[model samples]
Target chain A: MRNTFRASMALVHTTLGLVTGWVLFAIALSGSLSVFRQEISLWARPELSVTPSDPLLVDLHALNWLSQHAGHAGAWYLTAANERSPAATALWPDAKGHYVQRMLDPSTGSPDGIRDTLGGEFFYRFHFELQLPYPWGRLLAGVAALALLVGLISGIIIHRRILADFFTFRLSRGQRSWLDLHNLLGVAALPFHLIISFTGAITLGTMLLPWTTLVLYPHDITASYADLNPALYSRPASGHPGHLAPLLPMLKEAELHFRGTGLEQIYVFNPSDRSSIVTVVAGNAHTVSTTSDVITFDGPSGKILKEHIERRPVIRAYIFLYGLHVARFAPAMTRWLYFLSGLALATVIGSGMHLWCLKRLRRPGHRGHRIVFRLNVGILAGTPLAFSAFFIGNRIFPATMPDRAFYEVACVFATWGITLLYALLRRSNHAWPELLGADAVACLSVALMGPLWHGGYITAVSMTALALSVSFTLGTLHTTRKVHT
Target chain B: MTWISLLFAQVAIGFLLFGSERGKRIFFEGQLTRERQNFLKFCGTTSLCFSLLLQLFAVREPVLDIIQWIMGIAIEIIVAALLCALWEKEHNRFFRAASQHLRK
Candidate 1:
């Protein structure tokens, strides 16, 4: 019975590793790239930087323009520019249900004419959400994270020499090199792997906590969220005729009153109504909560209405966990380290799957492992190739296309789906070289055309992209040659 | 579950180290003779020291801290035993004794 249980657990571990392996690889790879998200953003739009003045100065002017344009409207929102971004953004509801977003010059408050670029934000979004509908993608990532935690635990169990094995990489032996690489990467960054997986699970605890909530609170999720963070609340405006005080004066007043870090964002509620309240969120740059005391002002009078900050330990702990995951307040160097570590993690997972295939192929009568082998090839090689195709499409697709981001995403999945199909139809051994080669070509194409297409060329970022693409392409080709010989 | 997983992983690490050292002498000279205990002592002592540092980190989380500390100590004890066995030049005999004990 114990033997049976052990086998069952092993089966679970292997199955989970294979099933989520590709998604985890994509998550890790993109997460690594996202570490340099801000730098990537600057590279994406260089024209925005030609201005000499601080973005904050322009933000105040833009606020004045917006306020004048708003006329009798209750409130206006201004998202100030910082180092990662050169342009300020303003958002307000304009009779339509959707928020209107416009880039403003920090020096002039006029339109910056800089095109919309998601920059590293794409990887950040893709990591947890995969551009799928919010709840579903986040939930799936959470499940994968749990599986990763299990895989890491089981992987150690199956390996006999975790440390002496560290210095033991026999590259001449076929699958041995891959296995050694996988184990070395895993053991070397063991702390990060464990912490990231655990914290990832915690960040999506909302999906997991429903069972607890159902058992204890009769399935009241809203009440649970409220209980967890009570300072957050929403109220519709009471129907009445009134006016809002000038936002510029209020902004100046708040800076003096708060005497804290720079402001994060100004959230305006019910901007058209008399009861509209403008909440100025001050930045807590040193800490992770992204929380500032909400200094609410009556829209009409610009009078200070309410000020509150979430200071409790439990809530603070939750924010810290999330902040680490998001790198919301992290310095640029930390983000880069996070990115490199994430990339290495993806390499670990990818090489691990490769090791499995190489091992099973060596055994006699390998029919049982064939299906797993084919699936691993399809997912591991196919996902990155598909992701590169997405970026390539982003540059090549006509700008006039409606829902460009949607189309961009569709291209990615379609490419991936086709790669899987190809893997199934052709010799499985061809999967790695072909898909990797294709991805390399596609990424190279993006790197070449990025300056032409985006009109912003920073030598460092472009060179990095080109180097990574070439390295991936060349590495796969080397493996293919090695396998053949 | 987190603590359990961590402990399980660390145990695997210990067994893995023990298994890899099989059929290999501790020193490069390749005889089974157990002279030069300095390297062996350093290995055990350094491992225990790092394990203690890891324990200090583990203690921040109350429920997991004790479990982590136990696992760390257990792994250290295993390492010490393996080192002593190597020093005593009786690891094979120790393995033989264990297998016989299991058979009974």
Candidate 2:
């Protein structure tokens, strides 16, 4: 092995990418879809017709429903209707104290009777959570993000001629073309790649690095959370039952206080107590920082008790980092950039994985390479296939099926598992085009089905899927004809 | 729309630079005049700053707009690279017309 600094970095570039490529690929692709999470949610549940409704009225109805059904819940949450998502949502503690969330039809102010599915939230959650239980998924995602950071830095070191190579792309040369593409994409979105990764790792920092919190609060981990993300105002519930003042007026008051960005989320704490608090958080339509300007009102009097706009540099820094990752404040144009760049990142990971396989294929004893090649094919091609299958499952499953949300998730994993099994079982050369061909079909199906069942900007998702189908078709054809170096 | 304008402006800078003798080593190669090299660098830098200002004035979210500007610059490099790589003389229809009109 060469002992130069660049060579060592090249080793790191290859190793880190190989180690984290599949997980990063999954995260990146899901993240690209997650960029349009709300739009996809609308497309998934076509039963909810888009109707212009007053936020105040919709929220009032949600409060009415909550007070009737879950009035005694320790707390209640309601999200106001927005342009992208017409239906509001209500979340409250169930009989078991665990949270239950349901969509509220703006027309009725009651729990929506629409088809049950996680919708776009499946991808948004899967982007970070990977459908695994709680902290494990977050931890894995955080680690993969960190690995991506190292890989990027190493790639920069190895790519000494970054400026020189910026305009050079020799197409149709198999391994060389992939190398150029990987470098091209990496360089093209370097700033985005750096920021997204740094912010992503920081977004899950508490979970990934528990020791940081432990250092500050040796005993009370909860205290650390309180300091990190403090409520606008909080208090213990009084034993004596007290009124939660009419919510619509308070919401209107908050709207005036927020000065027209609109109310995002409402929290009614200790709903039945004299010490009750209603915390209204501002929407992120106006600011880059994710920290909401909050106004906590006296539940009995419907007057503001405390208000907060985050100004602390330390906390604002943290909020800025988190907001950069979530991008709740981004407009449509910025969101598209996030989506397109995320796809480029995924391409980089896929090409890197393929590069690893391609290099080893030249060796005489290529048995180990075969396993990697199979894994690579299964993951790189299988993921988008499974993502499309999730949408397909949404439409194909009977609307009234119990636990339909779980079935949608299962469809994704099952498709992924079967593809993996097929890849491993079949010859690599045959597996490549076949899996990609299936992906193309699934994408095409997702694209064509959207107009039939849904309308509005949800066509954006369909159009994207249509584009993916075309790209996959081209890739499939190319794979069938090309011989790897 | 603002994003597109910023991107296209950056690509114009790309075109200007790639229009040179393999812009990468122009300074090193000494084939181009020193004044011309400096002039090219000035145009590219000025275009980038102009795009940054456009980004700033277009949106309320300054922080996100700045981040967007950086990413836009990064992406434009690729777009410019692709055009340079794949497209030949036929692609410079506007540029050819401008030159012909100037000669006339």
Candidate 3:
């Protein structure tokens, strides 16, 4: 019985690992990059890398401008500013009631840049949705996460010496090295991998478990939410004629009411309405979750009335879980750690696939090994190269170009597809070095071109590229020498 | 009393069951085996007793639906085995199916 169980566990691990290795790697790599998604956006568009945007300062200027411009319109929404840009953005209903965001310089109240530059939002959107039209992309990502969970379980079951595997890594042994690296990373971060996988799965559980609602409550999911918490769906009315009270005063009211330290977001509902309320949501930064307790104040009177910490437990739990998954409360250091860990996860997936190819190449009957090899090259090598190309396109592409984002995405895929074709056609012995060399060259070229293309110059970006290219060139030389020997 | 408490408790029970099962198999495989078995039996019976209580408390049907679905199958199997064992005690003339077949 024990032997049978052991055999079954091995089978489960091998099968699950092979099936989801690439997808897992991609998800991890993207997620890791997503931790610095905003910073990378700044990197991509070096043109916008100047002066950090402060919300308080931006809000003051934006409110004054919005008050003057929004004559007879509904309440204006100032997009909370941060370290990304100095422009303040406001969204308000036009004569047709459609929402439009206008970007204004906080100090001057003059228009600066277009509101929809897709800077940081590109990463935020790509993290879950991959820029694919709603539901489908996010659903795909969620399903991949579930697959990753299964892979994690199967990996634990299959590994015979988890502890021994923890400390072992082979260098200069080709496939053995790949397998060792994969095993080492997987075992080292097992707990985090498991929690991250499960939470990520549950984060999308509502979408995944739509059938649960169908079977249990056919008519009303809304009722389920209400049973959990009535305040979950409440929103303030619009079109009220009232000036918003100062943010600091409302923030004080929230701190006094919720008994929390900092404020997260201030939602001004019905800013134009005389009865409109300003809701300040207090943020407890020390906690893993930012399920804020809100204090709503009358916009005109500055009188605080409603204080809501959502009384229902289940609803609060769900909100907290969601917030934890988003990791909004994490400090910069913590985020960087998470990002590096995610990079290791990406390496695990890439190495696992590489291992499969290596194992197959040793035996004679594995005909599809070549295909797997090409795919690993295309995905792992091509993704980072594509990423660098996006930066290049962001700089080099004419600003007047229609749909600059669409063109940038096109450039990325074009470079990536070409790299894959070149990898497949090139000799197997030379392919690894060649592909790495090509990517390094592309990165370096783009890095150098940044100054030529855009007036803004980043010494750090250029230096990083130079270092990467030197390493890749040295690696290429070493590989060629080994092959000849 | 809070619904979040119940959710945490459910997760805790799952972990506890897994941990106890592992402990019994690994650390205490000798004299304490019977005690471990009895503990598991008691947990099973207590879970059955609280089935009704669980249904009454959590307002959401989906939550109840899932809980009942998992627990109902477990409870049914346990109750059936207990009944079968009691019936075997009463019917001394009748041999169990597997034993009678093996005798042939």
What TM-score does each model's chain B reach against the true chain B? 0.34, 0.60, 0.33
Once model 1 is optimally superposed onto the true structure by TM-score, how far is the C-alpha of residue A147 displaced, in angstroms? Answer: 1.4
Docking class of 1: incorrect
What 10-residue stretch in candidate 3 chain A is worst by lDDT? A226-235
lDDT of 2 by residue, A279-366 (tens): 9988866777676678899999898888876677988898888888888778887888898899999999999999988888987767
CAPRI verdict (incorrect, acceptable, medium, high) for model 3: incorrect
lDDT of 3 by residue, A449-469 (tens): 545334322554566456656
Which prediction has more favorable TM-score, 2 or 3? 2
10 residues in a row with least lDDT, candidate 1 chain B: B20-29
Q: Which candidate number maximizes DockQ?
A: 2
Which of candidates 1 and 3 is the stronger one according to DockQ? 1
Each candidate: what lDDT? 0.64, 0.82, 0.60
| Candidate 3, RMSD to the unseen true structure | 16.3
Best by TM-score: 2
Query: Considering lDDT, which of the candidate structures 1 and 2 is the better prediction for this target?
Result: 2
Task: Give the clashing pairs for model 1.
Answer: A32-A339, A58-A106, A58-A107, A160-B16, A161-B16, A243-A300, A244-A299, A244-A300
- Could you estimate the TM-score for every candidate? 0.75, 0.89, 0.68
lDDT of 3 at A331: 50
The segments of candidate 1 whose C-alpha lies over 4 angstroms from its true place after superposition are A1-9, A50-55, A58-80, A89-95, A99-105, A108-112, A212-233, A238-243, A252-260, A288-292, A363-371, A398-402, A449-457, B1-104
Q: Please tell me which model should have the higher DockQ, number 2 or number 3.
A: 2
lDDT of 1 at B101: 100
